[model samples]
Target: MKHAPRLTALLLTLALLAGLLPAASAAAPQPAEPRIAADSAIVIDYDTGETLYEKDADTMRVPASMTKVMTAYIIFEELEAGNLTLDTLVPISDFAAQISRNQARYPTAVPLPYGGSLTVDTLLRLILIPSASASCVAMAEYISGTEAAFVQRMNATAQRLGMTAQYQNCHGAHVHYLTARSQAILVREFIRRFPQILDYTSATSATFNGTTYPNTNQLLPGLAFEYEGADGFKTGTINAAGYCLSATAKRDGRRIISVVMHSDNNTTRHTDSTALLDYGFARLAADAPYTDTAFHWSWQAVEELDALGAELHPSGEQFRPEQAVTRAEFTAMLYSALAADGQLPPLPGPEESTQPAETAPPEDTAGEPEQPAPEPEPPFADIDGHWAQAYIEEAAALGLVEGDQYGRFNPDSALTRQDMMVLVDNFVELPEANGLGFDDDGDIALWALEAAARTTAAGLFGGSGGRLFPSASATRAEAAQVVSRVLELA
Candidate 1:
């Protein structure tokens, strides 16, 4: 719903790979544009609300049964209003019963006996699991007096949601209008608002009035077309709508929403969604990939960073595992760790600084005219436009980064274990050395001895043979594990 944000992430990656950056940047290849057979499709990161991929997504098409997603949304709204409960027995009206009994008209309907009753919970399962049309009509009548009035609510809700849609009915029977993009947005909102809806949508089969109804969605568990983590939403195939699906799935704690409209058939509809979902999943994984980290001893720490959120992902590149952690990388990780806890104070970028240079010439000169002073050495000459510039700048502003002897940050140079302790010591008082002593304590610089002793005593460095290796360069894996553990301690 953000302005022009559609496919922005994908376009940025594409533009970067199109010779805008080094070939190595593209070494972790971006997933190719999926071969989608659907007339329109879209995929979005459910967490960021950012579009990961799209194809003719804004072109309006009949939403078909996907419209039931909204029906469920409204029903959820009504339930929250105290007007209905899951166990509330809804009356089986003449209209609803008539539609149910009319096999030619409502083939998906599980025939309801006239004047009989089913609970709102049962009806919800019937509609979601079986794509039962009469169940929708029944629920709509109970909520708004008539399905026609419910359609008005649906359209109004769509408009309120800023969806490009025109609702003609409660269930997707006759016809309705919705774009693939809008459908994705609607489902995103629906799931966000009523995540419990998944309890019903994830069901592969349900029994109604002693007749069992299998889920029309083939993406559920144990089906031939089943996709791992495939859960809720709906499917439809009217002549005009063709085969359409609005589907969602979660893998590795990340959820994605996709809509495939006008696919050739039911199988291909799932096929198109699978491709879109896979594209989305791969894109997010690339942001903080662990494909290279699994063999490392700290692989769990690397994976935990993904669960910790985007702050840990810095520049969306895999950390060099065996390589030494750099000063800039440490600064970025520390900044992100503090930020994730909302502990970062007001800090401005280098460009936002208003202070004069550290060695500025005096404003008043008594005799000779003063010439403009030469600019003082920058905090770090190498950081401008660097991939970790923002984090480094913020870290520098907070005094978390101090450049080396020549006033250079040495952003790419290896950070030693003692140096890691010094930097980390800035956040909290490193526990005093107490009685702890390492075999290599003499190798630690006098400046870092207390921090080295304290951090080692704290078990940050799991020394072997009583040697802490204080001056040895810390690997990326060690840095990540240390930082992650620090976050947990914080």
Candidate 2:
């Protein structure tokens, strides 16, 4: 929570940039780049590894927590190899626990209760979200029996990825004399090894157990150069590393990777990442075969006319795939698609729009045509009377709302840390939140698992009852508490 001040500063930076820029100016900033605080920066097309821009990129500097990106890659590979699964719980070793409790320059492990058990999936979430040092130590120990072995694995992976200038220590804490060139090479090597991980770095915000913590890398959000293609990588901070980031984004079927190290603060890290992403996308735009759309739909649009309540039509025919989509339209389309897919009930007709207050039929019902079945109650109505209902509706219209079993939004329900996570997860695209965290598994409710992970990661919610009560309703007070935190981080 102490990061509030830093987050505020970052928002101010974003606002100033937005106010000064024009929509048509998504192009990369000009060569007269502002005098920035970064020690190193580089941008390359992920598709061809072509260097788009570089400034002291080859100089070696502290890798800082950006080292976790490599650590995560190793963990992911192990998971893919069947060496690990979300359910594999690991105990905290003395050394790992020490790291977890160690209040290094960054906050220590989010106070994981001593000797507590956590799953590999959850461990990764903690590592990616808060850059929880203990989570990393615990994970390394779990995988290799010791941090030493884990470091060995990290260095081995580095060699395989062609990070010739890079090396590693047991804990990823910065060490002596790692040059900026070495850091850039390490980042390039990482991109070559786990090209798909861009998804994690670009996440704007995530929730873990109802607590939300935003990605320190501001570029993922539209705040930085309108990064429509931006998705993920990682962010880091330490006197040794300053502020560091490895960012990845896609556009027009092309992908680009950018790395910045030793930046001043939230402002510099954000601006540097933006400049790199901008430069990368600019090259692709110039090389495009023609004017291209930034977005397109993969699923067909459903258009209901009658008993054909569940209908599917080609995206281009029934709905223009090329047309930009509003949040409301997108959500409605999603709900309609789910209905067609049997995931949700059909939309209510005018005659069936309202539910009767009483369950039993009226006394005169015998003489009347059988009443049309009541339309499903709108989930959001339950909270209409709740304070902040307007804000909730705004979130819902943006597809940021969550619902209960009976399809009620339950606005008055007291929000858990996990609920906040679920809400943020869907509203923003963040790969790091996907199936990450100890409490997230098949047996757990999908919404709960997602919410717990995202909110926890985003620093919004903390779990209650040893688990996330996703079905629980949220109270106005509780919702405001969490929403205020989110807005702060945002």
> What CA root-mean-square deviation does each model show from the true structure?
12.7, 21.5
- Model 2 lDDT vs. the true structure? 0.55
lDDT of 1 by residue, 1-490 (tens): 0012111111112222222211222325677779999999999988668898999999889877777888989999989898899999999999899998775666576888699889999988888888888889999999999888999999999999989999999888777688998888888998888899999989989986677888888888986589988996788777788999888998756788988999888889988888888888787656545556533466556656555442343345555677788877776666665565445444322345677678967766589876995744335778776777666654555565667787678778889988898887765445566434767767889998776667766666676698878778988878888877776665
What residue runs in model 1 are displaced by over 4 Å at the alpha carbon?
1-27, 287-317, 320-332, 335-490
TM-score winner: 1
Predicted candidate 2 versus true structure: per-residue lDDT over 138-250, tens digit per residue: 88888898777888897787667566445455335656234444455555655666654554555565566566766656666655434667776677777767878777777
In order, the Cα lDDT scores of the candidates are 0.76, 0.55
| Candidate 2 backbone overlaps, count | 59
TM-score of 2: 0.49
TM-score of each: 0.62, 0.49
> Backbone collision count in every prediction?
0, 59
